[model samples]
Target: MDMASALASLSRLQHPFSRQRSGWLLAGTLALGAIPALAQSTSGVDGVWSGTAQSNGQQVPLKLEIHGEGDHLQAALLNGKQRSASSSGSYTDGHLALQFDYYANSIDASLKDGTLTGTFSSRGRSIPFTAQRNTKAEPSSPNPVNIGGDWEVEVKSSKNESAWTLHVKQSGPNVEAVIQRIDGDTGSLFGEWRNGQYEVSHFTAAGPSYAVLRPQADGTLQLVTPAHGGTTQTWTARRPQQARAAGLASPDDPLQHTRLSNPSQPLAFSGKTLDGKTISNTDPDFKGKVVIVSIGGSWCPNCHDEAPLLESLYRKYHDRGLDIVELSFEEENQLANPTRLRAMIQQLGLTYQVLLTGTPDQLNEKITGVEHLDSWPTTFFIGRDGRVKAIHTGFAGPATGDAHRDLEKETDALVKKLLS
Candidate 1:
């Protein structure tokens, strides 16, 4: 189906926690009142439903719990094993209208007796979901959107800061693409797209890096920026209107930039906190805490998003002896001065000790070079004994909510192990 319609179908899926968040739900319900509800039928699908979905040749079992009042239909996916991604739509007429974040369109599924026995389309793939209603069954989750094909994507950074042109091809569930730099030389990228989300391992002429994209329902895609840690913008592709091979490639040249690692390299420092508190590598106070040293700036949008999450983690685990030090890269040259650094920390409401690193050039020289740093908001986790644990570069933000979810899961596991 078309992108708009595909998105609508995915939007109909809902989260189980909706009722608990009444304010947000109320606003959404009011805004979405224009959409039609499920069709009025003698089909007794007004309860819990469950089934398996084999879409685009991938099979995933789904459990759906529908709460219907009169003409309105609200359903939640009962399975938490899948990600928390959900949709909202009304069942009206014979069509099941739904919307999802990963599609640029909504989907209209023709259902017979709560079964998706008719045609359905999402992310340019039109397939049938042979759904059957089970009174005692839970709902099944089909994959989100399927952006499985050859695509020519051009990413223009906001305000012409930078741009990347990609010639991406999807083979089955795997993603293999070549990105052309501004000078026309090509670098490679690899990953996969399932349910309309992209987990790409981006490499310039450099080494391994990462990127995630969320396809919207209106055929427009949301580019989850790793730099700013939040939703950035919407992009729509103009597919060639002519008949071409489903997995075809164009001869156009792609844009390129310096290759940087997705997870940037670690930087060492021997500095004090932003509040003029003496904290050096030899400090006895940090002898046994899971420490995190960060390279970030308050002016950076990506850093703004990451700082809050870091603050959340600190608050949650600081009592358990989690020590965090932020190395600030302010616009001023005297950034290493603690008095100036504390102002930046106060402005961001960051309770952690922030040390002023040197100038950006000096900062680059002191830490690993900036060329190795793909984006801002870089983090390096340290073990209790002070050795490096992991380096996470770039912030995917709430736009690619799933990526952040995975990050939280990883962090929790590590923290739990340390606590234990």
Candidate 2:
């Protein structure tokens, strides 16, 4: 059977959570309306529904675009340029449901008098959600200020203090923004300048994320981002050089953050494939081949982004002695069913060998060869001689623009070097 067909078969394999389906991999589109990459609000219960999910008492901006009506509905969650359409959708009795099967995540709410009130839920965690028709936005500023360029952002919460790079490209009122950290970026966030502040949002099968920014008098930007757990975080951002000059650290290079404990030692690891077959480095498929071993989970968004690239690379170089293996560390429930992992493999058309390891928390403990293995999508390159060559700790996805391209190019070059 074809990949999609196989995925569909696996999806049909029932689970305890009836609402949990591989929504990201399902293929059904409804042309209810058009929500451009950069968009404003529209009227009715079907168009673009915009609002905030309560975050630690703060609000994070989000946009839900729904088209069609009744039993046949097309819906997508919008966050800047990142638009994730529902794999499954329904509308009945003034109630709407959109499920992104990939993460077993769903959004269910009731529509009343042009308003939507409900909750976005995953596993056992639920976040209160409420939105109204995204009304047409009118720029309050006669001259929309330019908040373009690279910004050095600093998050100041009692729990976490980290530095991030914020990239923004603006043309008049439209804006495209993202935050790049040591591990990966937050994907694309598209918004327009409205009122006196800037608002951007992104939602996918992974969940919802929204940020609001206002320029301050001291030439800095006050950033408020609503995150999971119903809590919002306020941060400050300035130019890259300025932040660095003020002692704000830069993001660690992806290739330099994670490394092998012994460069000359061969990576000794093995895990069980879906069907319960154990594959190891000594396997014939891996012996004398240049292998790329990726450590990540199906629930991770960055891993979702990196899977396609890994698949593409494998297809391109597999005949030339390139071998790729993915060690998936998923939730315990997934270990039993693996519907999401199956969907990802089918959606990406990955032909590489995939094995089920433990969970994400078991990463460091399960793999004894590496240090600083904190990132979800770390990649290890093994040379033909069976020695470790290089390790990349994080993923720079397409949403990162040039950085992502550069990483791909660098990887290709490194693989070529290892093969030679």
Candidate 3:
């Protein structure tokens, strides 16, 4: 892949934001009458399922929550505790197919008796999986040690080392965890204390996701996660206080990571809306308006997390002379059809204009007046003066705990300042 596509492909690897979600839980089996078209064929396969995908020899668990009417289907691959997803599909014959529309991935499964066998496929890679109807049972007893709290985690990757915040919450034997950077976090890792280690599992519609946490005698955590090429990455965790006193540095400030080529000038770019109308800072709708320019993609997980936050801001400030425009990059298929993009806007109840900027490979060539875009979901705050006021790279959504809230407050304050 070229630089732009590589950046886009790899940008939101560990990013997640949160919204109030009425989760689709695995609840036994769906009765024969649940879906009209599949009533006869999908009787025992219509409800929630416990599934695992086998990549190499590693198994990653996920919850498949299926509920729909007629031939249409709305499915959720519940990865860990929080999955920023949007889905659609159909159930025909004994075959079931689910598309993570925005994420640009899908699952094709077939049911035999109560067992479900399928392949979760994305972007040319496919992992085979097997699932079975769930039995709703409470979690087992708590772990011998509660590894619940925030800690400073240092990840040692093959190419580099980076700092991350490990947020873990445990209930009985059920444990939920996510690794956070200043930008955001990995969506969620939910599992239980199994054997001698805490096995936290995650399965995004794309890529590998699983982590094993072992509590050491020193009251810290040792995490081992699978990486590219069957290699494993190791992480050491320590309390923030301990990390701070030991003089470990944190991730860089997001606001400082990206900047404009010239702050005195407006962002120099135009994009075609989903309907093919070009819009830019020079447009009248943005004239004298405190505008927010968001750079993202429908196929991005972090971008999915950041959309609602932008929508909330736009809804609150649009009438007060604020306008938010999303310049969304996408895959070739979405760039051509944009069906999923429209579905996403409707699914999220977004009213702001989303422009189809270009394919991921065209990102750098399409945008101007920016030094560089460090990550997906980057935002530029422009004042009514038509000058760039601030540029915040990446998102610190609810996944970052206090940092997300803090960023929201800061964003509100900045918008208020720019509007004033």
Q: Report the error of model 1 at residue 66, Å.
A: 42
lDDT, candidate 2, 241-282, per-residue tens: 878789887756677778788887888778899899998888
lDDT of 3 by residue, 1-420 (tens): 753344233323423222211111111111111222322334635666766677644676656656554455655555444443435578777788877655556788887777889987765678888887754433444445688888888754221325777888777666777776544466566667667677775665544456788889987789776655666667789888878887887655678777877777778778899878888778877888999999887766567778888899999988899999999988888889987688678666789989998887786788876765646778988888888888887776565667778888999989888888
Query: Taking the tens digit of each residue's C-alpha lDDT, what string does model 1 give over 1-420?
Result: 963354346543421111100001000000001112332223534444444443323322333444443345554433222122234456666666544322222345666644765333432444343555543322223453555443344444321223333445555555443332222212223444555576443211011123454666655444432222222334333233311333433422211122224333333576545555656656777788888877765434345446667787788889998878877665553454334334334434678777666554455665653343434556777777666656666554432344446766776677656655
Give per-model TM-scores.
Answer: 0.39, 0.82, 0.82
- Report the poorest 10 consecutive residues by lDDT, candidate 1: 22-31
Error of 3 at 12 (Å): 27
* Alpha-carbon runs more than 4 Å astray in model 2: 1-46, 67-72, 132-134, 138-140, 154-162, 194-196, 226-234, 244-248
- Name the candidate, 1 or 2, with the larger TM-score value: 2
Between candidates 1 and 3, the TM-score winner: 3
For candidate 1, report its TM-score: 0.39
Q: Which candidate model has the greater lDDT, 1 or 3?
A: 3
lDDT of 2: 0.70
